[model samples]
Target: MKAIVLYQQGGIDKLTYTDYATPEISETEILVQVEACAINRLDLRARQDRPEVDPFPHILGSDIAGVVADIGPRVSEISVGDRVVLSPNISCGQCNDCTDGNENLCSRQKLIGFHTNGGYAEYVAAPANNAIFIDQSLDFSSAAAIPIAYLTAWHMLITRAKIQPGEDVLILSVGSGVGSAGLQIAKLTGCRVFATASSDQKLQIARQMGADFTVNYKKVDFSQFVLDQTNGRGVNVVLEHVGQATWQQSITSLAKNGRLVTCGVTTGNEGQIDIRKMYQKQLSLLGSALGSSSELRTIIQLANNGMLNPIVDQTLPLSKAQLGHQILEDRSNFGKICLSPTLSAE
Candidate 1:
């Protein structure tokens, strides 16, 4: 099978479209013929500096939608030719966290692309438990766009923050996949959504997506904007993932007793916070990881029901995945970048 394989981590030049051996699934795993795979910021960081446990000659894509080409002997529910998407997080089913329906917190959790080989190839294998059959109406690209970003957004707002209707919430990086999903999620609760972006064009789309207010962080100080808009009351919740660069400001933008949930630190780690302000405000700071399998199922159901829609901005063939990475790095695209593994010539 042909795949975009990286023998070493550094820049886009490390990725090469080449042939690799097809994986042999274990008794409980299934083989999927990759249709579409979504590019994420994690892919960018991985290319720059591969994470621990990542092996060389690695295939780097997390969210995927594909057809089941084969199933292992123990796989019962899934069948050949079923259209499906895999939940990126793999957890041991018998663990305490898994039994408690908190699979995202499982001690043995492994995110597909990060801890294992992923879907940036013509064919890939995954645990049968991780595959959720999708309705025929949804395309591979849209399905591929759901797992990581939407699940993370859903978990951040719905589970961790426990956002309620009429509450005010601020979403950072309104053009990001998570930001776009966060805007819709907040609107679903009838909450007033405040969004931030680096440009007018992205801010306009945020407004269209039901953001009550949009700020260009490049031009104005977003924390002050939030305070001014709310008359110094701040928002009930703040969805922050941009890490060190936005940490203190995100804390500053929160209302009294407000919840702040974060998933990633794209900027840099090691953010500082004022101990006095934290105690005085009585704020709740939470760290969110990839969501549970149940949350992924809910997002899938919502997508199937046409309530949730993932924004896939553009797609490139598997052979041209380097270009997709460049688009993400440059932050030029709005929603997501998809790769069609089937488009690669063998």
Candidate 2:
């Protein structure tokens, strides 16, 4: 098998496409012939060895769309030759959080491409439970974009914040995959959505995705815009994934009793907050991780029904996985960057 292996974590240069041994599937696992994979911010962080380091020669791609080559014993729901999308979140099904239907909070949780080998290869082994069968109507590239970004946004907005209709929602970095997903979800909930982007081109895309208001953060203060738009009341909810860079402002741009949910911190993770303001405003801060399998299923249904759509910036062969990472790191793309592993020539 040919894979984009991280010989040593540092930069995009470390991601080399090379021949590697195919993984042997466990009795409870399935062998998936990789079709497409998506690049994520976590991939950049993993490449730089910031959060942590995966073992050398690591395959780093979380969201995947592929065909099942073989199914392990006891996997009764799905069978071989099934077109599927990887769930990305792997959790201990018997844990307390998992039993409580909060698998995203499970103590034994591990994200593929982060904690274990991922789908940056021609084939990979995954637990049968982590495979979601895609409807034949969907393409592999679109299926590959769903697992991480959409699921994360769904969990943060719907599950964590419980966003309501007629409310106002502010999303940071609206050009991002999760940000685009957040915009669509907020609009679907009948909320007036405001989004911030670094460029006017990106802001236009955000507006097209259903954001009621778009702010070019490069030219104006987004916090002021939010306050002015809400007549000094601030938004009802803030979708914050950009982290420390926007953390304080996100809190400040919220209405009284507003909910703020965050998933990742791309910028350095150190921000000061006003405790007095938090207390006086009665603000609620929530931290969300990857979403549950049920949430992924719901997102799939939404995609199928045309209620939600994954924004794909570009598609490349898996051999150019490093290039995909570069594009993501530079923020040069509007949405998810996809890699087709099957197209790689070993």
Candidate 3:
């Protein structure tokens, strides 16, 4: 099997493409022949050893779409030759949170690539329950693009914020995978959408994705713009992922009792919170992680029906994983960047 291994995480040079042994699965797991895998900011941080790096020579990837090449003895629900998308969020299914249908809240929750060797290879081994079957109509690349960005956006806006039709929603970092996905999701309910990006090109793309109003945050105060657009009422919900850089403004752009949901901290972690403002406005600040597997299924269904779409910026061979990381790190890519172990699809 061919894979890009992180020998001693530091730079792109550490991600060396080479042949590695195929993963062996336990009785409760399945071996998937990976067709496509999507690049994420998590992958970049891992490459630079931001959090912590252990167990050297690891494969890094989370968003995976592939075919079941083999299934373990205990996996009776799935079989070989089944096409599936592996859920990136891994949790111990017997925990209380898992039983309550909130697996993302489980104490043992972990991301696939972050906690274990993942899908930057020709084959990946995952729990049988993690593989969600997909119909033949969907290709591997598109399925690979759905797991992280779309699922997080769905959980933030629909499940957490409870967005309603005609409400005003704000989406930040419009060029990101989550940003673009959230823009589309907000429009699904006929909600008025406000989007912000650093460049005009990204703002234009956001408009094409149904953003009602677009702002270049670099040149203008987006929070003030939101207030101006809503006649000082502010937006009903803010889909905020960029952490410290935009955190304060996101809170300020919200109307009274408005919801601000965040999933990532691409900027800096430690953000400032105004206690007085929070209490006075009765604002809701929510932190969301990976979504429920059920939400991923719903996203997949909508995508198959053409109501949602993956914004894939580019696709490269597994050997060129470093190039993909460079594109993402430069913040030059407009959406998801995917790698194909077998170069199966673009």
Alpha-carbon local distance difference test for all models: 0.90, 0.88, 0.90
C-alpha displacement of 233 in model 2, angstroms? 1.6
For model 3, the superposed segments whose C-alpha errors exceed 4 Å read 51-54, 344-346
Write model 2 residue lDDT over 1-346, tens digit each, in one string.
9898888888788999899999888889999999999988988888887555555668888999999998888788888899999999889999889988889989888888888889899998899999988888888888898899999999999999999999999999998989988888888889999999999999988877788988998898899999998899999999998888888889889999999999988887787779898989999999999888999999998887777778889889998887898888888788899999766444
Q: Against the true structure, what is each candidate's TM-score? A: 0.97, 0.96, 0.96
TM-score of 3: 0.96
Model 3 over residues 132-226: C-alpha lDDT tens digits? 98878888888999999999999999999999999999999988989888888899978999999999998888888789999999999999999
User: What stretches of model 2 exceed 4 Å from their correct place?
Assistant: 50-52, 344-346
lDDT of 2: 0.88
TM-score of 1: 0.97
The residue-by-residue lDDT of candidate 1 on 154-186, one tens digit each, is 999999999999999999998898888888888
All models, RMSD in angstroms: 1.5, 1.6, 1.6
lDDT for model 1 comes to 0.90
**lDDT value, residue 194 of candidate 2:** 94
